[model samples]
Target: MRYTDEELEVMLSNYRQLRSQLKDIRESIMVPHVIQDTNVGGSSSGFISNPTEMTAIRLAEDDVLNEIKNIGLAIENTYALLPKHKQKMMMAYFIDREPNIKELEVARRLFIDRTTLWRWKHQIISMYQIELEKLDSV
Candidate 1:
């Protein structure tokens, strides 16, 4: 199958939009909180049989970090192809090591609801997978 210039243009635009949102998503990983509770290993009666249990609380959406990595890579491949508006937004949102940009701020700045942000993220992952597959096929 083949894509016309318009279709390619739209796809590229969507990628940039998703990349912008993805930029913020990548920065939103929760700081890992390790609960270091010292179990005195008291009387054996009610012992933690294993003695230690570990759990993690992900404050932000978990998969977003993973998707950010994908978006970063795909953006690298396609960055030169992006328009200026998209380039700046995507770069600032995703690739920079600047201060943490809050999620609510990002949502408000993009004029999108939280759920739409999630859907955009999902689309980025799907599009990245498709692009990667095409490269692999080549």
Candidate 2:
């Protein structure tokens, strides 16, 4: 839903890590689960409602995967919604910050001074919040 600037920034900063985690989870899910044979004796005790802890672990992993996917989708969708020039800014600042692009480099690439770059970054964070709001509505 709606996110604060700090939250949005954190999501963007961790975007790459999220993608890697999503990939890892998908790969793990592809692995076959070990099947264990359990023998039941007629001792009327409903002590455990759930039979298999593996099922619970699988459900939790699915939940985590879904959460990471949602965050990644929102970030990508927001990035896609921006104009080409703004997308460049976002890419340099967030998605492609591996080597950490300098302010001068970004300014030169976007043909703007440092002040405008900083302002545009703030604007982009606001845009991300708005985009997340729209997603929540849907």
The candidate that wins on TM-score is 2
Window of ten residues with lowest summed lDDT in model 2: 30-39
Candidate lDDT values, in order = 0.48, 0.76
Error (Å) of candidate 2 at residue 105 is 3.2
lDDT of 2 by residue, 1-138 (tens): 566788888898788899889988866765546434353666775343554565555546587677777788888888888889888988887777756668778778778888988888898888777767766565
The local lDDT score (0 to 100) that residue 97 gets in candidate 1 is 19
42: Cα error in model 1, Å: 70
Candidate 1's residue-wise lDDT over 1-138, tens digit each? 244434443444455467667656543432233434455677454323342222123323356554444434554665554556544444444444134776556556766676765555444434544564554454
Give candidate 2 misplaced runs (Cα > 4 Å). Answer: 32-61, 136-138
User: Could you tell me the TM-score of candidate 1?
Assistant: 0.35
Q: For model 1, what is the C-alpha lDDT against the true structure?
A: 0.48
